[model samples]
Target: MSIGQSVSKHRFACVTAVCAIAAACGSFALGVGRSIWFDEGYTLIVESQPFARMMDLLKVDVHPPLYYLLLRMWISVFGSDVMALRAMS
Candidate 1:
């Protein structure tokens, strides 16, 4: 790419990153005191399981397992706390 294009792409990436970070922080802050919704709780429980077990359980569920698997990675990195869980969205 040309230098101009490269600079534009870099700027776009930076702005996008900032916006994403701000949004996640805002959501986590707003949800700070509230209990996790039932669906969130269910998601957490599922994502917290061992991989094989998680796969087995997901076989019977309608939702895709990829979501839970990615969420499992997120939980492993950040945490399983209410705020951390909220930030995933």
Candidate 2:
């Protein structure tokens, strides 16, 4: 491409990368030290159960199962530490 177009493309990429980093840093900072509240505690409880049990609980509960399913997978990969769980969000 032309010089102007090339510069514009590079600038766009730089801006996008910077914004992504800023957002990630902000999210981690906000979430890292925070304690889990009642709803989050329920999520952790469900996540700790077996997959089938979690599914059963979801059936009676109003929330969807997909998040729990993904959280299960995340826990499998990352372990159930608070930091890991928070980072998954």
Candidate 3:
């Protein structure tokens, strides 16, 4: 409503955005290039397959297929590089 209030709100938003971006960057930097764990390794294997095959495998596997399906699409757009894959999270 008031000029001071608006400026304060804008400054708060900017600070929040900057903090969020910095946190994400720091998290990604720490995780990037790290060795894939068992679950992520499974994701890599499942996501690399054909859609139908991935689905079929999921039928017998314990985990759901939704994440793998999305990962498949992500890999299609971004390639299978480790950093790119981890960043997709």
Candidate 4:
């Protein structure tokens, strides 16, 4: 590809990134104020549990703990409040 084509691609990528950020900010701002969806509620509950208990719960649902472990760390720092949980995602 030529220099001009490469530069154009970079510009498009940057613009897309900016627009995506803007859209996420707008959507999540309102989302935090709203009630959690079923899965989001379940996530909060699962991640808040003690690790051993959390593992048992995950087994019933047949999910890996990787994501929940990360989320548990995130919640420990930011909290499990709707706003905090929504922000991490």
Model 1: per-residue lDDT, tens digit, 11-75?
A: 99999999999987787678988988998988988777788888988999999888887888898
**TM-score for all models, in order of appearance:** 0.68, 0.88, 0.82, 0.72
lDDT digits (tens) for residues 1-89 of candidate 2: 89999999999999999999999899888877688767778889998897788788899988788888899899899988777787777
Residue 38 of candidate 3: its Cα lDDT?
80
Candidate 4 stretches with Cα past 4 Å from truth are 1-10, 30-32
lDDT of 1 at 88: 77
Top candidate by TM-score: 2
When summed lDDT is taken over every stretch of 10 residues in candidate 2, the lowest stretch is 31-40
- Write model 3 residue lDDT over 1-89, tens digit each, in one string: 99999999999999999999998999888886688778777788888788788888899988777778788888889998777778777
lDDT of each: 0.86, 0.86, 0.83, 0.86
Least accurate 10 contiguous residues by lDDT in model 1: 24-33
lDDT of 4 by residue, 4-62 (tens): 99999999999999999999989777886588888889998888788899998999786
What TM-score does structure 1 among the candidates reach? 0.68
TM-score of 3: 0.82
Looking at model 2, residue 38 earns an lDDT score of 74
Determine the C-alpha RMSD for candidate 2 after optimal superposition of all C-alphas.
1.4
The total of clashing pairs for model 4 equals 0
